[model samples]
Target: MADDDLDPTPVPPRGRRRQARFELEFGDFEPAERGRRRRRGTRGTDDRSVTSSDELTYETADPLPAPRRPRDRDVIVEADDATYDSRLVDRDQRVRGRSRRARRADAPPADDVADEIEALERFEDAIETVRSPSDRGGGSDLGARVLVAIPAAIVAILLVAQGGWIFVVGIAAFGLIGVWELCRMFARTRPSLVASSAGVLAIIVSAALWGREGMTTALVASIPLIFLAVAISVPPGGMPGVAVTLLGVVWIGFALGHAVLLRDSDHGGGIVVNVLVGTFLGDTGAYLGGRLFGSHKLAPRISPNKTVEGLLIGIVTAVVATWFAGLYQDWLSGTDALLLGLAVAIAAPAGDLFESFLKRDAGTKDAGTLFGPHGGVLDRLDAAMFAIVAGFYVWLAMGGVS
Candidate 1:
């Protein structure tokens, strides 16, 4: 063979070159299948020009699948605007898909769809109906409240009757539990519950043993311990966490500690009973009054359900209840009972609102669920904390206690 014959890129003749002898057998292949084969084989040879308008329907005999619309794109149409289409249009000037209303319009009316719409409407109505004024003060949870409150009240009375180290221990235990609940509320801040509980226990015990001075000393000393606790925390919250821990100890711990001091005083049982009766009766009156006749808000920003009418009713109820309770005890005068009731009335709501403020800031409905529907220990004692402190002062002013 010649070297020129072996060259792959040989020049064609000046005239027409002879074509190669090639044969393709189609056998039983259809016209479209043959056309597709030819097009694919001659892709870069320019044998066929595929235009944009050509629909390659022969790729498969089955029709093209419809584009899927996202389920979340279904818009909730208002009852009033049920007939209106809410389909959106993109920059491409094409409707995204059928909206909820549009689909409902196209489909024949069915019982299931109508039932779903009706159910949604009923759910909204149910929500509005349950939003009662008493929601702030137990509301539908009254049964649970009563069940829990009864035993708790009896125990508290017994503790007051038995005034000694036992009473001190009871108060200290309450302070510890309250502080724990408060610490849990500041969980994000990583405040130390153990350290805070210790601080609260110390404050309560010191108040019982060495009086106010000892309690004051413990409160001051606990600050360093709290700082150290937060310092070694896995994810420390720095100075802010320290402040939060101190708040829990002082607000809950110190407040309950005053109860110990009150119980140790002259005519302490009577004084303590007077404060409890007044505070609890006032709380109950507020709830009942608000449920029945609450229209004007007392503090809409702080506590929406509280009403001015309820507060007035509570004040009157507290005064009456305290005076009645005083009749049982010879040492507490009617006038002094009335004064104590007034003090409790003012302090209780203030304490409740203060806790509400804290809960609102913490973005929680309740501090904890220790007392079932009544909420945590803090929730049950919020008003009592302030009431006990006020009662202590009132008793001191009357020279009943040293």
Candidate 2:
């Protein structure tokens, strides 16, 4: 069974965070799924129950040989666009472990090809929905709006923050909810309820402790995860095998917490808003540039859509965005805005790629489509979740709001 195939039960993104608590207790990979997929390929060719390999015409012989390392290899193309990573392509290339679905529509009805096709199709559509920029306008217009809206928002928030405490409380609540979404994206799903519940509990406790004492509390508790795996004697593919699961939970939840803290800080500081604006501008520039002029792939193995040209645009945008935001908002000076924006723009993509690696390893898409046309809520916030933390740390280094 694929990571997604482990369970067909649909749950809300909020619910997924609750599930994270359960996930931590169980482990990273699931038991039943790991076993099922492992044995599927290892089964005898003559067995009564033919594996997915039986139906395919691809290589069944010796595995493909590794590529020869080129000593200063010549560029394949005049431009910078590198070829797609075989691994990433393979994930989406051949529909593996799809018991209900076949690789293509040509397959016979016994394979339940129709249902599978529809599911894949819909899921792809949902991904597109999230990827598609809102219908508000095109690049130039959007850029202008961002330029205008961002500074206005920063100024308004800083001014308003001075007037009330309730607003701070509300932003903090948003932070908590965002944290919940982060937990859900990687929650335990296989082996049904048992693993999921364990992950959920682990995160909740982590959060409760962090909420009270701070991140160090969570860090201290995470120290024993590796030794605990040995004590449990669970092999690879079991929950205990996800080497950095404990740390991952902390990274996602705690990192996101900074955004809430910044947004809701007393004395009406605009710490959080400044970081967010910077990240947003950087991402916005990269995205638009990639769409218009991107040719070279940044890291096809991790993500195909990201391009060198786009990345450059993103960096430039981050600086510009920050400068613009800082002009009207006193929270960040020219240098602070530029540096913070650049950091977020660069780091945000890394966070995105990490999540992609996780999802690809699990052989699932979008985590769960809690928000229709948007995949799961976590999918939408993956970059933001990590960016918040990165921004916060950077801010703290510079003597931030706290």
Candidate 3:
């Protein structure tokens, strides 16, 4: 046989060549069903052999199952402000979903909702009860009252300027008014006639004997007598009555009497003026500061509206006003003035808080409406009364006028 005709090295067939090429380019490519087909075919024919061409045909014939069509439930519906279906989502499921979303979104917890609701309700209640300054007649009444008070204050100052009976009368009248306000406040809780009368008498006697040598002795003697009177007159179960009466005598009577004593001191008029101005400035500063920058509560239980920022402003203004008053009147040295200012700063807030405590206990907003926007005499005098008593003691301790 000719060498060309009878070729010893045979070339691969077209299908074999293609299979070899495919194996080289895409190694080990086999259809998933190839093994299953072989197994099925071999079950009947034990000697069946799987061919590469069969595997290749199977790999080429099979296509991935048609891309899955998403079901209605699988599709997420997203809308800007779309309302949910009420029939699809019941109340419980809706609430649960909302709570879950809130938690996932880092929102406030469900428990805080009740607290916020309560706070808002309280705010609404407060708004209903306390009218704004503008709403309450545009402050015209306040202005008119101020005009009236200015003259009255000037006259009192003039009376205090004179020695003897004039000062006594002025002090007695002021103390009596304060006593009346206090008695009126406690009237529903107790019979305040005896307490009011006793308080006025004590104030009169204290003022009358203020400058005398035996004044302290008389003042000391009156306390027991006042207590005894209240104790006897007040019913057995009427401790509040006795307490109010005693409180009136001590607070409205003796505490206010110190103002008279302050007036009788060497630079008495200046001392009284300094205290009054300082306290007024403190109150004004607190009001403005609270209105402007108040955030943190000072005493939420006693006075929810009071703020720490306002208290700080009040203290600073009080100190500055007091120091200026001292310098103006030449009543105290710079250092002594500063000390008195500090005292006033501390005592003024204390007095205001004290009255707030009383009013809160008595279930009223103001002690009276005599001063219009200023509330009542008690409301206006609360801080001053405390400041005066504190200033008098400080004066005595510092051995009177520096």
State the lDDT of candidate 1 residue by residue for 287-345, as single tens digits: 78876787888886566667899988988888899889999888778898889889999
Give me the overall lDDT of model 1.
0.74
User: What is candidate 1's CA lDDT for residue 161?
Assistant: 95
The runs of at least 3 residues in candidate 2 whose Cα sits more than 4 Å from the true structure, single-residue gaps closed, are: 1-213, 222-237, 240-248, 264-269
lDDT of 2 by residue, 329-374 (tens): 7655788777777777777777767766666544466655544333
Clashing pairs in 3: none
What local distance difference test score does each model get?
0.74, 0.52, 0.68
Best by lDDT: 1
lDDT of residue 65 for candidate 1: 64
Writing each residue's lDDT as its tens digit, candidate 3 over 268-306 gives 777787888788788778867876798898998788888
Q: State which candidate, 1 or 3, has the greater lDDT.
A: 1
